[model samples]
Target: MFFNTFSWKEFLLRKIISLLTVLLLVVGCENNKKSLEPITPEDFLIIAHRGASAYAPEHTIPAYEIAQQADADYIEIDLQMTKDGVLVAMHDEKVDRTTDGVGFVIEYSLEELKQLNAGRWYNSANPGLANKEFEDLKVPTLQEIFSHFGNDVNYYIEMKSPKIYKKMEEKLVSLLIQYNLIRANGELPKVIVESFNEDSLTRLHQLEPKLPLIQLFYFKEEATLSVQHYNRLSNFASGIGVNISSVDNDFIQEVQLNGFQVYLYSINNEIEMKKALNLQANGAFTNNPDMGISVRTEFEK
Candidate 1:
């Protein structure tokens, strides 16, 4: 009786419209997934900034082990070079802040840098969380990190002050090759190379097109990226990493619309973590992996 009430042409048109609606929803869902690929390629990523730097001195083996123990998705490392041309994991150009040394990281030989007590500063800085066992940890070279963690862990490495380190890109690529972390066959590594300098990222991208390179931006105030900026970064960067102060949901949505993932920097607490999730960011760099994990769990629920 319902069929008899409608013309055959009208029924055919209705079916076609329904089919188009289904098609649009599928397309919309696929686009949503594309925006999320950088975060574990499907799941959200928790990058342990400086190996859970909140609990231990950053860039030390103990810090890295703590991050791994918490099952972090990636460990974020800021790399600086030594005078002897060794690549070491360190966040600052000057060693004064985190170590018992007073000079630029590049001025010291690996042996010289190693002599500095890398973990002592944390005890004095955070007396409540101080540990006597952190007395004399050595700075870890890139090779040492590779040897320690192997392929079981993913690394989010930044070439800190890359221009200051001659052939830093080449040396980094060489080590990755030596460790079989990258291949000439276009197989990608779990590693993601990021930098604040566009030129540094460009050089690294040229070195390995298969590698995912991220361009980082800093802002003292609210952050925003122009359409032109997004266009330019898309030329080389797989995505962009911005300070939490610099981003909002609109920025995240717009960047994703331009076909790039957006990762926020330095989320250290549940409030900040929730802000990141609320903004629909792909992921964030966090100093407390366990807390990040818990916040993500609760937020999803």
Candidate 2:
């Protein structure tokens, strides 16, 4: 019969093409890694806050790729676990703001969450930057991000509502190991973990001390910090990630003096970017990485 006549030539060609495609994707992400080196304290890095978020929907692949294209040092991901225990990229505790869905993000299973339109809200919010392409963006998982970017790109993952999401630390560590981002002795980890909860960061530190931790802070009174406070946090975290407005020259000086790197968050304008660089901050998380890079390059001159 005609069906019994097998084509070894076609089969071999299909396998070769598949193999080439996978290899190319890896190479492409590698080439996109402008700052392949793990960020050291001395390095002044511009982390893409939710991946050039001002241009594309936050926490989506298009935003991440655009940030990489802008040559940012890192892509920051805020994780929220689904009902089925899959970790996905999300910022707010509720999906109402980011997606065409209502209710807490944790209540939805991965499949249920995938059904929501994660990017349409961005178009309505920012019509000037709207694109039909972004309207269909899906919420990505930690495994997916790791698979897409590989080890070449840096990952700055922020754990949200750590107390509510029990076993998050364990799951994250397992995933990091699974992705081969975990480094051996004397090798810097490809991933850095950040959170506002000291206990969560401490737990993560215990799970993997090699992975650098960043302690985040929010202040209603003021952004002032005492040496005693710094000493307390220094035990588990290598650096601090704070609101840009919460930090001033004095705050930056204090942090640097105490041997901690300062990273200002959500910096979206030239003034803020210039302020961070001029203040000698170790890093700045900006929603516009291209502008951040451009401002830094001009400032260095």
Candidate 3:
């Protein structure tokens, strides 16, 4: 009886040790997998804010094409899903501001949203920059943008209102994989995912750990971030994008020191663009990619 009891204990102990060893090996394998490289100040990306929005209607194909022509590093796309579960590029949650249509983007099907003129409102608002060709410019689908540009241009895509579009992360990741934007063999993919919603970013990080992510911050009033905040963000994101007014030289230095890139948004004026360059921002989201590229050239020289 004593021998039998000892044999059972020995068997249990060996099984526990073997289980732990397997777990440790699995953990080691995971740790060995390479993480996506963080974007550094040396990158000096020129992101087109809604694709040269200063020249044409925001998120329209013409604007994106113009930005590509102007040599922007990445064309930013704000994504929202329509009623039929298709992704389209538009900044506002409702199409009223940018399109002749008046309704929530989620409320209308892609075909229904397409019926409304997207570019006429821009022409009316910016009279001096208006063009007849801008009339009846339709809202573009994400597929359309991908088809038109392919991998020739990089994309900085924002998951707008991810909470509202519950399946957006899944859908976006699927499309990226389908389009071969998620590369294998440790090469950097041209697509970057960004969002103000941390959960959305987290969901993307889980789905594709290799996909580079930028966490966006919108500041209504000026504020400074703590080291703790930067450290927490560094756990999941490769970079941060903030409203240009929210950042200073010290802020940029601190964030960069902590191994995260800083990108400032919507800098259209040359003076502001030059200031951003002086501050050594890793990138600037500009409505005029031509001006952004030119300023970067002069400043770097």
Candidate 4:
């Protein structure tokens, strides 16, 4: 009886050792898997909507540079075409709102647009809320912006009304390649191509399979997409960029549960910004990168 009892004790000890070995292997694998997750809150991406428009004139070189200075993770650019078929960075379909020019942006050649003062109109008395520092800014081109900023900063380029310009995607992608911004050693300037039109985004995805695309929406209520549309987008888009008003805890949770990253846009107020952070949004697009970063820092504390 004593001999049999001793053998059973030895067998139990060996089984425990084997179980521990398996546990160690699983723990190691889990640690590596967590590391491989593509996105994280620690990234805390800050996209400067329209190149820090709150502080500078929107979509101008100066405004983009200001975004960089303000430590924005990405400078959002709006793509439009000139009469000469050149791709330029300006937000409006018409230049009347942001530029001294009175007609459509497409009506003027690149040369004519260059000669116009794109900045003076937004001076302290009007659009800029009377900030004189915004004066004399010029609209930037895709080429010029790439040359100045290089691949050091992230770019969130919006295909603003691409139907008007059939070659908008081709032009932007060609420029990206010319600058060697398409693929780099590590985290090559996270270029996020966003569009309201799913068809435009689908075309871009076909062109560049690896580049991340975001579905942008400006709905007044919850996301209007049916379950079928949402499923399709989930397969195609890396994430969704929603207007701040459209995002809430329930909606954020629903998307998160579906394994989609949610990014809220143009959040300027500290209160709303804090609410977004609480929702654990992947990122926020803001016109004031300085204020955005400041609020993010506070929230972290």
Candidate 5:
């Protein structure tokens, strides 16, 4: 009887060990599923600020072409008006900062704006990089950008001045339609329109409810306002676009909690670039698309 009892005990012990092993195997599979899950950074996009302005003068075909060559995911184009009320790709309402002109872009006709030396200012600080290879480069129209680089690159168009708010959405949508950028078959160019003037974006949303819109904010207390404003604007925006100084994981997380993405602007340095990635930002606007691409590639490795 003692011998029989010993056999039964040994059998029960073996069954308990086997059951524990099976449970562990099931738990291991569950853990693997969690570990192998996909993350956002894997598909994060890169936007070239002002058409890779670090390599060439901003908002010109030469600059945009460089952005494409650098493999940027999108080329940011800021829009302003010419005297004739035509939309042109430019950062400032005034041409004094980046061109050889002395007044507001709207003051000159397209013919007059085209004649100024757009490449002249580039030679002052970056002579070696300037070389005037693109000297006398003329300002390009919204239509011209689409004509020259259509469908080949994505665009991040910012309606710079709300003074043209009346015609801004109509003109932009018309051109995008002309170029077939807003696809009928669901192949749109992934255009993202941004503006500090919330009403401008709201207007676009009213016009084309499907187009992605971003709410841009810039303030002295940039970091603090980033969260507060993004929360308020989330009702109308798909994402938040703010100065690089304003981006942080906290802001990004807060934006994400509200079901919005984040795009940080004008980051050109290695430190800030790395910070953007570490924060898992949805995208970055950079003057050097090549630098952004290279660092992003390295970090993934």
Candidate 6:
């Protein structure tokens, strides 16, 4: 009886040990799999620069709708604050070029700005593709844009002239939270804040750590970034946007190696789009999103 009891005890012990060994092996395999996974550059993002500005007046509802049809990854909006502290989409500080209004955007109240003809300028500028529906398309407030698109589309928002608008960052964060964009979980939102101002970017990072930010750089001449510059930017920004002319294969590789995403901006043609792709840019901001999407699709094929 004693011998039988001992044999049974030994068998149970062996089974327990074998089960633990299998579990350990499984856990180790999972860890190894994760470790060995390649860090692929993010899937190419075709950001519509001011909502397919090539086809329609920029920063208007019509422009955004057309961008959606073109299958852009994100609708880029340049935010400028009005006198009444309303955030509106306008790329330039002055409204003379894009709208009938001939003053700084900040000088007009949102209501006054809405009264201006935002679309007529486009029709006049591009008579070849003019549409009657483009007439009287009012300047859209940032809130209006969010309400119109909701979670259906992603936003690449730029805090234009952050230094000029002292409370822009606070107001932006508040609006983002109000829109249910600030979540407790680490999941990325459909919004990304970008600016040429580092101070604004840093303030944004402080307000919402989970929200990704991009540092935008504009260069008249070709530019090269040092490791220190990449590291400094990485401290506050998840990625960098550069003029398409300023970036090359080495620049993209260096930035990616330092774990920062690189995006080339204002690429409106097939040749530049192909060059951006060849450099393995995470994305490119394009006035012609349709062209960018087509080139990307063909490249993938």
Cα RMSD to the true fold for all candidates? 8.8, 22.1, 14.5, 11.6, 12.6, 15.0
Give the TM-score comparing model 2 with the true structure, all chains together.
0.83
Q: Each candidate's lDDT (Cα)?
A: 0.82, 0.81, 0.83, 0.76, 0.77, 0.82
Question: lDDT at 191 for candidate 1?
Answer: 84
Worst 10 residues of 3 by lDDT: 25-34
Q: Please, what are the lDDT tens digits per residue for candidate 5 over residues 203-235? A: 887777667778887746646443345434544
Task: Write candidate 3's Cα lDDT for 1-301 as tens digits.
Answer: 9999999999999979855644554344344333655553355789999999999999999999999999998899999999899999999899889987798999999889989899998899999999998997999999899999988888999999999986899899988888887652233348888999998988889888878899899888764665456545655788788998877786676566556678898798999999898888888999999998888898889
Residue 95's lDDT in candidate 3: 87
lDDT by residue for model 6 over 1-301, one digit each (tens)? Answer: 9999999999999979855644554344333321111213346989999999999999999899899999898899999999989999999999999988898988998888988999998899899989998998999998899899887777889999988786899998888888876542223347888899999998988777777788899878866665456546656777789998887775576566556678788898999999999999899999999999999999999
lDDT of 6: 0.82
**Between candidates 3 and 5, which one is better according to lDDT?**
3
TM value for model 3: 0.84
Clash count, candidate 6: 0
Local lDDT at 234 for model 5: 47
lDDT of 4 by residue, 3-87 (tens): 9999999999987985564455434433333111133335567889999888677888778888999989889999899988888
Q: Compose the digit string of candidate 1's lDDT tens values, residues 68-164.
A: 9998888988899999899999999999998999999989999899899998889999999999889978899999999999887788899999878
Candidate 2 weakest ten by summed lDDT = 29-38
Residue 217 displacement in candidate 5 (angstroms): 1.2
C-alpha positional error of residue 138 in candidate 4 after TM-score superposition, expressed in Å: 2.1
Q: Which stretches of candidate 3 lie over 4 Å from their true place?
A: 1-34, 40-43, 184-189
Query: Sorted by lDDT, highest first, which candidate order results?
Result: 3, 1, 6, 2, 5, 4
* TM-score, model 5 to reference: 0.81
TM-scores for candidates 1 onward, in order: 0.84, 0.83, 0.84, 0.81, 0.81, 0.84
Task: Using lDDT as the measure, name the better of candidate 2 and candidate 4.
Answer: 2
